[model samples]
Target: DTSAFIMELPAYHLPYAMTVLKYALDRAFSFVKRAGTIIFAMNVLIWFTSNYNWTLAHVDASQSILADVGKVVAVIFAPLGFGEWRATV
Candidate 1:
């Protein structure tokens, strides 16, 4: 059996420095904006879960829903390495 492969390449050219810089800055800003929004949302979720109980009443971090779930997951991950509830969360 034989196989044939053909490839085509475009001519090499130097990119305009200003255009490249502007493009990089634009992409960086876009990524930062998206990441900031997601991070903010996650912080809010973590705060809510770590401070509230199933009944929605504020509680100590150790007694919150996040802690409960973390403890359960900690047990499952114990043999793999560090499995402390705090670490799991």
Candidate 2:
């Protein structure tokens, strides 16, 4: 009876699994897009500040902040293939 009941089950339940997988993939793509935008903004900001001229003392302080931000952003966005993005700017 157990074998007969198992055999009676529907053979086509894959659509449900495919739907769930598609939903998960969509969420992951959205997350990557958001992360890319954030990394782009940070890179632009760093480039802007680094190019701005200031007094020697102020420039030193500003450089430190920029460097720290670069390191943090690098670590956060490493998995997104942004190593060149960080280095280029």
Q: For each candidate, what is the lDDT?
A: 0.93, 0.65
Candidate 2: where is the Cα deviation over 4 Å? Answer: 1-15, 54-89
Q: List candidate 1 segments past 4 Å from native.
A: 1-12
Query: Quick one: how many clashes does candidate 2 have?
Result: 0
For model 1, residues 1-89, the per-residue Cα lDDT tens digits are: 23356567789999999999999999999999999999999999999999999999999999999999999999988998858898888
Q: lDDT of candidate 1?
A: 0.93
lDDT of 2 by residue, 1-89 (tens): 56655645557645688899999999999999999999999988766566544432345523545555666677767787765334523
What TM-score, to 2 decimals, does candidate 1 have? 0.78
**TM-scores across all candidates?**
0.78, 0.41
State the displacement of the C-alpha of residue 7, model 1, in Å, after optimal TM-score superposition. Answer: 13
Query: Top model by lDDT, which number?
Result: 1
